[model samples]
Target: MHKSYVGRRRKNPARIEMQEGNETPTRDQIESVVSLYNGGELDAAHAATTELIEKFPAASILHNIRGAVNARKGNHEGAAKDFQNAIDTNPAFPDAYNNLGVALKKLGRQQEAIENYRRAVSIKPDYAEAYFNMANALRDLGRQEDAVSNYKQTLRIAPKHNGARNNLGVLLNKLQRYEEAVSQFSAVLLANPNFADAYNNLGLALKNIGREEEALASFAKATEVKPDYAEAHYNKGSYLFDLGRRQEAEASYAEALRLKPDFAEAFRSLGAVKRYEKDDPQIPYIKSLLDRNDISDNDRMHLNYALGKVSEDLGQHREAFTHYQNANFLRKKFLNYTPDLERRLFRMVRESFEDVERIKNIYRAPAEPFRKTPIFVVGMPRSGTSLTEHILASHSQIYGAGELTTFGMAVNSVWSGGEVTAEQLQTIREKYLADMNRRDVAEPFITDKMHLNYRWIGFICMALPGAKIVHIKRRSIASCWSIFKYYFSDFGNGYAYDLDDLGEYYASYMDLMKFWEERFPGAIYNFSYESLTENQEEETRKLLDYLGLDLEQSCIDFHETKRAVATISSMQVRRKLYKGSSEEWRKYENFLKPLIARLGED
Candidate 1:
C-alpha cells in the first residue's frame, strides 16, 4: 500500500552548530524554540522565536521557525514576510525556499510560490515534496500539462506518492484521456482500496468510455466505502437518471440531500427526476434557501432554476419566466460573451463557405477510403435533434452516439493554421472514427447529433463526402424561447442567457445553414420538427429511407427504445410524440418580443 505523507515542519538537528558571533543565540536556545513550534504551542513558540531572533539577528533558521508559527496562527502575510526574510538571510537554504513557497501559496501568490518551488527543487534535486507543491501551484494557474509533468516527476522520486497519482488521474480525465485516467485511478485503488475519491473518479472515466455497468459498480463501491459521501451519491443519481432508472435515481439524489442538506446540485437533480406539483414541499424549501444571504451565488442560481422548473410545471408561466430570467442573469454575469463578437464569427463562417466554387476548387479527396457513413444531425438547440436521433437509433444498424464534439474538435485542429491538405483531412476522419470506436459504436450507420455541428457542415462535407447530414428545423421563435427557458451549463452556448442574444444567434444560425445549403447542394436532408411531430409515421419512414434502411416498426415506436440520454430532452424523448411543445412559445409571447424582433418574426 502507498503510504500517505502528511506535511509538517521539520528541524535539522545537525544544523544546530553554534556561530562565531557572541550575540548569536546558543544552539540549545534555537532547538527549544523549534520544539515549541513543532509541538503546537503557537503563542509560546511565537514569543520565544521573536526574543531569540533579536539575539540571533542573522539566523535564517529562526526566521523560518517564526514563519511556520505565524502560518499556524492564520497570519499568512506575516508568515510570507518572515519566510522571505529567512531566504534573504540564507540564500542557499533549500528548506527556507520551500517553506517560503508554502507561505506564498497560502497567500494566493501562486506564481511567486511556483518560482520559489522551482528554486527549492533546483537546490535539492531529489525534493519530491517541492515538485508536488509546484505541480499544485501550476494546476491553480491552469497550466495542466506542466502540472502533469511535475506530478509524474514527483512519483518518479517517491513511487508511493498516492496524492500525486490521484491528481494525475484528475488531470488526465480533464484532458479527455479516459483510458489513462482509469489506469491512474486504478493504481490508487490497488494501493488503497478504501480511497472513496479514487472510486468516484474511476466511475466518471468508465462512464465516459461507455462502460455503463462498470461505472455504476464503481459509484456503488464509492458509496459503500463512504456512506455519507454526498458527491458520490449525486454522481450515482446522475448516471441512474441517464440510464432511465428514475425511481432509483430519485432515491440516490434524496440520500445525497439527506447527508448534505444544502447540496444545491442534488436538489436540482431531484427536481428534474420528478415534476413538482403546486404545493410541493421541496419548492418552498428551495425558496427559503434563496432568501438566505449566506448561500453562494452558484447555489442561488441552481435554486432559481429549480423554482422555475416547478413553476412551469404548475402552469405559472409568468412566474416561471421571471425565475428563469433571474437565474440566467446571474449566470451570464460571470460568462465572457458578446453578441457582436458572435455575429462577426457567424459572418466569417458564411463568408468562408458561401463561395461554392471556391470551396470545391480548394477541396481535395483523401487517398484513404471513408468507410463509415456518419449521419450528422445539426441545428439550433432545442430544435428536436434528440428526438430525431432517438427515432433513427431505433433502427437495428443505426447507433446513436449522442452529441459528439469530436468532428468540431478535429476541424479546429486541422484548420487552426491554413488550408487543410488531403492527408490532414484523412487524419481527422481517422480521429473521429477512433473516438466513435471508443464509445463502443459498432453499427454500419451512426448518428452524431451534436447540434453545434451546424457551423462545420462545409468542413464535414469537404472531409467526408459520403456522410449524410440531417438539418432539423424548428420555428425560430419556438427554438429561441426554448433556449431562453433552460440553463445551458456549457459556456460555449452563452448566447442563450439573454432574449436579444438568443434571437440574434438564431438568425445567424439560419444564415449559416443557408450558406451550407447553397455551398453543398443535395448533401443535406432538412427535417422540420413541427412537421415531424404532426406526421411521425411519414417523417420516420422518410428518415429511414434516407439512411437506406428498411421501414422498421421500432422507428415509429421510438419512445420504447432504452438508452442513456444526457440532455434536457432526456425525459421528453422517452415519451410518445406530442404536439403541445410545438406552440409553447405563444404562452410568453410578450416576454419574447425581443427574440421575435431579432429573428425577424415581428
Candidate 2:
C-alpha cells in the first residue's frame, strides 16, 4: 500500500518571465497561492492560480501548483491537463512529469503513468520520488521483481525513504524471503520509530522465521503505537491464535472488528475461533455487511466463508454449502485459477521419477553430515500432516520445522527435468541441509511438514537417505471438502477451489506417491490418518517404532504441547484426538455430489 509522492512544492518562482511589456508577478503573489494550497484551501488555490495563469500564461510553476490543487480536489483530469501544460512551458521540469504520472495512475492508465515516471527519472536520475512512483505502478501491474528493483533504486537515491523500504520489505515477505524482509523492516523501524505498518509487517516476517515471541511483541507494539490500526490488530490476533492463546486472540479480533466494522478478515478470523450457538449475534451483524453496496468482492468472499462456518456449526448443512459455494466461486474468479498449471508440474515430476533405479543410483552417495535426522511429512493439505508433525514434535527427540520450502527450493534450483545427476542431487542435499542446520536445534530429529512435498518423495529419498519420510493418507472426500471450505494463503493450493480440479489433483498425487513407493520400497513409511485418529496410542506406537524411537507420553498427549501451529488445524490439534471428523462431511453429502463423483465414494 505504498503511496506515490507526487513532488515537492516549488519554493523559488522568481525566474519565470511574462510576455513583452507585461508586468511579472511578485514573489508574494506566487507564495500566496502556494499558501492557500498548503493550507488545504484547494478551491481558493485553484481560483487564485487560474487568475494568475491568465496574467502569465507561460508560468510553469503556477500550472504545477494548480495541478497539485486540482489533484487534492479529486479532479485528476484537470490536474493531468495542468501538469501537461506545465511540461509544455518548461519541457525539462521533472516535478511536472512526476505529478502527471500520479494523475495518470489515478485514472487507471498505468502504462501512460509509467511513461511519465520514466520521463521524470530520465530528466533527473536522482528523482527518488519519481522512481518510487514507478515502483508503485509496476507493483500494481504485477511486475514484482521489477518493482523490487525500482524500490531498491529509490532507497539508493534516498536512503531514508521509509515508504520504499517498507514496500520492498512487503514484496520480499510475499516472495518468502523472510530473513531479508526482516532486515528491511528492522531498518525501516530504525528510521521511522512510529511506523505501525512496518511493525505489523516485521511481525509477519518474524513469525515466518519461527521467532514467535519477538513476532508477538512486534504485533503488540504495532497496536500500542496505533490503537486504531485494524490490520495490525487482526495480525496480532492471528499470531496469538497460532500460539494457542485463543482467549487473547479472540479479544484482539474483537478489537479489530470494533475499530473497523467492515474488516472482513477480522470477521473470518473471529469466526474461526468461535463455536457459535444458534442465537449468536455475530450472524446478523456479518449478514448486514453483505447487504452493503460498497462491499467489495474480496470482503464479500471472506464474509461468506465466515457465514459458512457459522452455518456449519449451527447444523445448517444446506446453508453452509450455499455460503461455501459463493465463497469458492468468488475466490476462483479473483484468483483466475486453472488446475492445468499444477497438473503439468505433477506430470513432469512423475515423468522425471519414472526411472527409479537411476534416481536411487544417483542419490546412493552419503548424505550431508547432520547431528539431527530430518523427517519429512508429506501429504495433501488438510490431511493430518500438521497433526502428525505436532505429534512427532511433541516427542523429546524431535523438533517440528513447520512447512519448510527449502527442499522444494533446492530441487527447483538444481533439478529441471528427466534424470537428475549425482552432482545435482548433492547440491540439493547440501542446500537443504545447510538451511536445516542453521536452525541449530538440540533435538535428535526435526520434522518438515510441507504437505505439498508429496511430489518430491523420490528426491527426498535420494538426497537425504538419513531423512525419514511419512506419508499420511486420508479419505479423499473429507480432504477435498475440508480444503474447499478453508482459504489457503498459499496460491499453490489453487486446485482446491474447484471440485473436479481438486479430485484430479488428488488422483495425480496418489499416483505419484504410489510410483515413489514402488520405486523406493521400504524407504517411505505410509500411515492412514483415520487409523491414527481412531487408534491413537496403537498407531502412535507403530509410527514411532518405524522411526526407531520410543513412544513418549508427550506423543500421546500432543494436545498439551505448548508450541505454535500455523495452519487451519492449529485449533484442532490443540485439543485431544477425536473421531467423527471424517463423518462431518456427510452432513453436506447431498450438496457434495460433484466432489463425491470425482472421488468415487472414497
Write out the backbone clash pairs for model 2: none
- TM-score of each prediction: 0.85, 0.83
Displacement of residue 261 (Cα, Å) in model 2 is 2.1
lDDT of 2 by residue, 1-602 (tens): 11111222233311222122234356788888878887878789889999999998887888888888888888889989999998998898898999999999999999999999999999999999889889989988977778999999999999988888988888887766788899999998998788888888999888877898898899889889888988887887888888789999999899989999888878888888888998888889999998889999989999999999999898888899899889988888888999878877877888887887876655675744666788999899888999999999999999998988788878988877767788888898888878887775889899999887888887887888868989999998898899989987765777877777788888888888888888888988887899998899999999999889999999999999988898888898899988889887888888889779877884
Which lDDT values do the candidates have, in the order given? 0.80, 0.84
Per lDDT, the best of the predicted structures is 2
lDDT of candidate 1 over 1-602, digit per residue (tens):
00112222233211122233345567788778878876879899999999988877788888888888888888888888887887788787787788788888887899999999999889999988888889988987878879999999999999878888888887777666788989988998899898888888888777767789998999899889998888888888887777778899899889989999888767766877888887788888888889999988878877888888888889898999998898888778767578877776666666665555665676665656544568999998899999899888888988887877689778766665444456656667778877766654567788898899888887788777778899999988888888887777665788998877777777778878887888788899999999998988998888778878888899889889988776778778888999868689898888877677777885
> Candidate 2 — which residues are off by over 4 angstroms?
1-125, 130-153, 172-180, 209-213, 356-366, 413-427
